[model samples]
Target: MTKNNALGTNVIAQIGILVHDIEKTSQKYADFFGVEKPEWSLTDTLERAKTEFEGNPTDARAKLAFFDMGSLQLELIEPDQNPSTWRKHLDEHGEGPHHIAFFIEGMKEKIAIMESKQMPLLQKGEYTGGRYAYMDTFKDLKIIMELLENDN
Candidate 1:
């Protein structure tokens, strides 16, 4: 697994760019930056894989495909039939970097640290493999912070 120094702790980390179309954007980035083919996954597929989110016996669909851009991972998201965080972001703001996710082990502690600094969390809920927490730091910048935990 990849790791980086965040808030003085070694954390799983990546920079992300939110795009409207995955394949198109991935190609653009690859051509412009001379990068290789990107790794992709659908959010619905991920959600379906997680029993915690499934709750019922049904096929799950994901609206996201991801590309690894060196140290950064660019994620393309499209809202499927079901409601998703990506859907909400696209609905609210066009296409852009919706959030900067900092993956850490202790979500609660990370949240507390942010809260202590007076940064209010915008969304708090459960999704797919693990828990998630979000905080909006800027509206014009179209940036937010995401705390994610994966079962893996």
Candidate 2:
């Protein structure tokens, strides 16, 4: 198979963890990282979301904490009762690391390539400046891969 230019060159920019409680989990992460204060992730506040679950439009929310561990970020997500990837992970697998993310430039094209490869989109949502989606890559990678397209 020929390599497509859609995805471009990208790096694993962040690690996401699903948690039962963001406040409690963030503290643990802070302690583990030996930081007195951890920065609030961009998702800490609801940012006018447009979400999808299993290819259908849906609603979801989360409280998140972001830590800058050099070039990589560690994020903790506590999902609300709504149907979402985080909630589903918590229900099926309990609290733990959920996915690794890459920030992409040509997001629309990248998404098409991923779907063409049979890596179906499990969940997706739009935030302030851009959007994010999770690909169900468990059968191959045993973990989810998140693609993020941000305006800032």
Candidate 3:
């Protein structure tokens, strides 16, 4: 890792986009790429996700679909009418790029480093085998940054 690299790695694992209709968007992407449309599914339940938003526990959820493209994955997010980072972005920005994710270790340290850089945590949640956090870096980077730490 470079001394100035707060995220530890320079590789971007995923680029997430917010959409009003994931089904339609996924289909369009599939057609454009000439690949079968991937299934879109809801995120884990609130109980399983243990989601927190703006430092408070939340039941926000969204449907997700992923398309693996070479070294990076394109993530589609269709948020429910709940208060979440995804929902907020979709509502405020009206469907577009949301975040760029990086797989990293030491999530806590990475969060702190980001916070120290004036990028506060916007949301966080746990998935089946890993956890993720969204950092509010849009002002500086033009997009949020998601940190994924998997426990394998």
Q: Return the top candidate by TM-score.
A: 3
Candidate 2's residue-wise lDDT over 1-152, tens digit each? 23654456557899999888777878887888798656555342234666788877665777788888999998888888877888889999999989999888777777888888888889888777888989988888899999999996
Give the runs in model 3 whose Cα sits over 4 Å from its true position: none
Least accurate stretch of 10 residues (summed lDDT) in model 3? 1-10
lDDT of 3 by residue, 50-113 (tens): 9999999898999999999999999999999989999998888899899999999999999999
User: TM-score for each prediction?
Assistant: 0.61, 0.87, 0.98
- Selected candidate, larger TM-score, 1 vs 3: 3
- Candidate 1 lDDT over residue span 4-24, tens digit each: 333344443554555667778
Per-candidate local distance difference test: 0.59, 0.81, 0.95
**Which residues of candidate 2, in runs, are more than 4 Å off?**
1-6, 39-47
Candidate scoring better on lDDT of 1 and 2? 2
Candidate 1 stretches with Cα past 4 Å from truth are: 1-12, 44-61, 115-131, 139-142, 150-152
